[model samples]
Target: MDDKNSQTQTQINLVVAEPVIDIPTLTHRGPVKQRSPPPILARFHAGYFRISLSLCGQAFLWKTLGKPANDSFVIRRLLRLLPSTAFLLLWSIALFILMTLSLLYLLRCFFHFRMVKGEFLHHVGVNYLFAPWISWLLLLESAPFVSPKSVPYLVLWWAIVIPVVALDVKIYGQWFIKGKRFLSMVANPTSQLSVIGNLVGAKAAAEMGWKESALCMFSIGMAHYLVLFVTLYQRFSGRERIPATLRPVFFLFFATPSMASLAWESISGNFDTPSKMFFFLSLFMFMSLVIFFFF
Candidate 1:
């Protein structure tokens, strides 16, 4: 019995020592490399189309209004001359810069969030869409010879504003309603200081009225930066956990128009009747969609 057991152990050892070889290596011809999917040139193409569409839209509006082009014609012409390749290059550069800034901002927000407790900064990074839009609006409004009717333009502006405010109320509920954090913060000494300063600047500009476009300009600038910071913070902190149903609203407010405005602002030198009208119109459309759908 002992010899039989020894023989079985020896057989097992022999089998184990048979020198196994990897089948893949034995059968291999050359390197087995993983194939990656094709790069998304489609999105790039889409971006170019969108940019072209915006330019065409601007041109159409200007032609419709019979407005004469000023020195801004140079910038507009340059943009028009941008070939598809150049457009792609410009977009790539801009996207890279934006992405880098977004990452940095997100890191800062994360650091801040860790340092603080339940004091979550609401939608910080996610709000960056406002910057380019504000910039575009400023450029449009500052055009050399373009003066759009203020009342009609303001109506368009409220279209976006009212809906956005309403959406904020709906999504945030009591926070916006009771004016808890938002109102409190707005009323805070520090916040109020800034607000008052802005209002004063705006009022002074209103008084001077011509070159004193300072207040609205300042407001636009401040809003742009604020949106950028809020967007970055929200992105990093993952606070904008908006459900799928609410995603369209979120995109409307923060995504589509934001990108469109950014592109328009980046290339356009002068914002005139066309740009302002578009800005207000876009805002109105977004807000209207939100109000109609959500509210």
Candidate 2:
């Protein structure tokens, strides 16, 4: 009886196994065909991209703020081990892997244009689309091998920034042409991501000695940031509509100002009066939100 039941279960399992699709075979067999990725790849979305953003940001921070093992007395005592160069190299490699995986998944998503379009139209999903470009910009800035003034670096900047500007036009244009009702309807804390994308690009431009271009990008970002900021603060869009996953982006209230201050400093070449103001505002907001979230 047990052997019979076992044989039956094995047969059922074999019958229920996933299909092996051959696109060429299907196309040759008939005019109709569909291309689908493995189930694991199909489940990927913008939410899975958050980790790369965090990794790129940390890599950039380490490049800007970290010192060699020999140079840092306090850091040496704390970490008690590997050189900072090892850390940076590890992060750079990890970033490359993550970016490659993301690109492949994105290519798969693009193959299914309808799915990509649907995501583009989704209010929350649309905002997260800016993430990949932002990660690329951060990775560029943190690359120790590439000098900002190099021709290759210059070319790479244009490649990355152009998409950011294009997205700005697409998203911000909708807000402008569609007007306040549309803005109110779509506005959410993660909407601030659009603002950060501009600020990050502006900072990268300033690093490349493109002052006027930096200012232009910064102005557009700040202008819309103000509108989105106010709309979100006032709850004109209604708080309940925001997804639970995105509520953490409430932290952007402080982070946007922090990014703003950093971008202004890059553009102006000094942390002067306005830069100081932005810095202080971000600090206060960070502390306040820290308390709010904890309490």
Candidate 3:
């Protein structure tokens, strides 16, 4: 009986020792493998690439709108005038070239399986492209020899064109992507209002009212961020349906005010005069109809 008990204890000890040896052998067979995370530099490059693509799209719109000014003859006629015109022409050319390069880079990145960050880039590109137009119009107004009266018309025309092009792009992204509806893309109250706020703020700044402009821009930026969060929520929750009444409200409260402000600023020279009033009114009505029916 004593010998049997001793044998049983020995067997139990061996069983425990076997598992300990087996565990060490298994662990030593190979080093634990770990997945490396994507590098920060790669993320930065992806962001830049996306922004460049959006800018390229915006630049394409501008290029299609009008031919580049033929200033070579004007340059020959006046050497002094040549310097400024040459500078403007060269700057514009550089912008076009950079836009193209960025677009090609974006395509390469996409095909190579690099991350493509599109949303912020799209917004930034649109704003950057529009900046030149705004600057040119402002320069024309502020030049000692230039007339301020001409500013309004140019501003009006540009305001209409930029938004229309953006809207078209938004529509294309929606319909073709097929993951989301068209109105869902643009009908975010926060985003729409934020854009309006930015425009108003910029306009107010030009008039030497910085405080109001700052406040407006800040409010708009906040609203835009909120809208982005809301969009994510809707996407996750699968609640894509916006009320029927809200559709018209978006047209009225958001689209109309934007168009009206642009029109008003564009026609600021003759606000009190009756002659251009009808023209401006017609312009507003036309844009309103387009936004309501189409967008």
Q: Which candidate tops TM-score?
A: 2
User: Candidate 2 overall Cα lDDT vs. reference?
Assistant: 0.80
Model 3 over residues 174-292: C-alpha lDDT tens digits? Answer: 53475544334533432343343344334434343244443444344334434543553365434444446444423423332432343334335223443244346546656766776
Q: Is candidate 1 or candidate 2 better by TM-score?
A: 2
Tell me the whole-model lDDT of each prediction, alpha carbons only.
0.37, 0.80, 0.40
Candidate 2 residues 181-233, lDDT tens each? Answer: 27878888778888999999999999999999999999999999888878877
Query: Lowest-lDDT window of 10 residues in candidate 1?
Result: 187-196
The segments of candidate 3 whose C-alpha lies over 4 angstroms from its true place after superposition are 1-117, 120-167, 172-179, 193-237, 240-259, 268-295
Candidate maximizing lDDT: 2
Candidate 2: pairs in clash: none
Displacement of residue 215 (Cα, Å) in model 1 is: 29
Instruction: Return the TM-score for candidate 2, rounded to 2 decimals.
Output: 0.81
Alpha-carbon shift of residue 253 in model 3 (angstroms): 7.6
Ten residues in sequence with the least summed lDDT for candidate 3: 17-26
List candidate 1 stretches off by more than 4 Å: 1-75, 105-112, 115-119, 122-175, 182-295
Across 1-295, the per-residue lDDT of candidate 1 in tens digits comes to 9998887874334344532232222235775444332233211211122233234334333332333445466656666555646544543444444444444434444444442222223332223223322222332333333444455444434342343334333323433465433432322111211222232223223323423354353444345435433543344332334345333333334323333343333234355454465467558767766787789
